[model samples]
Target: MIKTIIFDFGDVFINLDKPATLRELSQLGDFQFNNSIQDLNNQYEVGKITTEEFIRSYHNLLPQATEQQLIEAWNAILLDFPKYRLDFVKHLAATGDYKLILLSNTNELHINWIKQHISFYEEFKSCFDSFYLSHEIQYRKPNSDIFEFVLQEHQIQPTETLFVDDTKENTDAAQKLGVHIWNNNPKADDVIDLFTSKSDLF
Candidate 1:
């Protein structure tokens, strides 16, 4: 029986435009901004660099742009966290039918942004039995090791844990570990709809 649900924060709970930062950076530079932005993102995820360092690297690259402008542009990807999702997740937690866990691949700046902007961040997080952030864990998803780490830490049977993520690759990785998963595409289907549809199973 599935006794736990693992959720990916960005795109799943909190909406994020994965490419918005790079798109904004593209507007600031003359050359193609694709590869460099990706490299910076990878470095940030792997804990090889800090958010300040990442922002400064980009700012230095685009000397014409002010630091505040670059920061705002980078943060634009984190748009809004809807109240409905929080209420839904809270409902799931309130039922006491399953253990809730949040596993997200994020860094300091994004976290600080959420803490400042989302009024319910603390309450929403409190609903979870465990909250794992990649930066704090020093590991990110789509990496099998991180998935294995969570399974071991929680003592959760892979088959009894459902992993929901917005990215196919991440979900696929978890699925390989024998965990049930849902690839939640925000544009195609909201997570609320998925939860509602799967209510009978729960």
Candidate 2:
């Protein structure tokens, strides 16, 4: 009896090399990604800081790295968005069988890169009934409040919503609120097999 579906945008849709950013940064001249930088990233993702401020922080940490270089390294994690996944989502949207939502924990630079690189980005975005980007919403996942906000905003029952994410941490947080979850492994699973992979829910 699922009436709403919530999807994560990163690995669930666009392919990502999770280690690419770190690898790129390490090569950018003595940039040690310590807990401080991770905190800064968390802050940036939640819209707590501006892009300039983010870059400035990085610049402060690695003085030798230019702004352009830092920005490039930051965006290295993003990869291509497969056409088949877009087709599947477009078909799903056309059915209009359930409310479709996209909930992602993303920052400004990554999104900007996608906008420039992914030709069908706008078309893909149009498929969702509601799209919640972390920086835009000022809320990121792995926290119950964000899920609560979504549930309340849409007036949807947690028991009737299905949240699909590539991260176990995010899915676990959603499941605590009584939502159905598919913690997909991007390496072994493609989102197009949603129904077959979790058929019991359907």
Candidate 3:
């Protein structure tokens, strides 16, 4: 039986404009986002570098951009958390039917922005039995080790868990480790479709 539910935060619950930062940064100056920047992002998400250093890395590239401007552009990717999703998750958590866990590859700036804007963040967070944010955990998804860490830490069986993520790469990684996953398309499917979509497993 599926006893645990692992969820990815962005696009799954919270909305994100993944390209918003690139657009905002372009407006500031000639900022090129290539493979190197993606590496820095991976490092930043896992708390390998400090927030100041993360911004400075961008600042170093686009020296013309001020710290405030860089910070604004960096945070543009994070959008709002909707109310209905919160309600749905809360109801699921209240049922005590399964162990709910949140696993997200998120950085400090995005999280801070959400806290500042979303008043009910704490309440929504409380619904999860285990909340794992990449920055705090020092590990990010699409890496097998991170998935192993969560499974080992919680003594969760991969076969009995359902991992929901909007990103295919992330889901693919988890599936390799024996976890059943729903590579949920944010455009067509919502996390609220949990029981109905994966009814057999439930």
Q: Candidates' TM-scores? A: 0.91, 0.99, 0.98
Alpha-carbon lDDT, every model: 0.86, 0.95, 0.93
Q: Return the clash pairs for model 1, or none.
A: none
lDDT of each residue in 1-202, candidate 1, tens digit only: 7898999999988888878886786777753566877778778877889878987888778888878877777787998999999998888889999998999988878888899999999999999999999888888989999999989998989988888898999999998999988888888877778667556446
Off by over 4 Å in 2: none
Clashes of each: 0, 0, 0
Error of 2 at 89 (Å): 0.5
The lDDT leader among the candidates is 2
RMSD of each: 1.8, 0.6, 0.8
lDDT of 3 by residue, 4-48 (tens): 999999999999899998999999988788999999999999999
Candidate 2 on 43-75: residue-level lDDT in tens? 999999999999999888888999999999999
Error of 3 at 180 (Å): 0.7
Kindly indicate the candidate among 1 and 2 with the higher lDDT.
2
Candidate 3 regions exceeding 4 Å error are none
Ranking by lDDT: 2, 3, 1
Report residue 3 deviation for candidate 1 (angstroms): 0.7
Give candidate 3's TM-score.
0.98
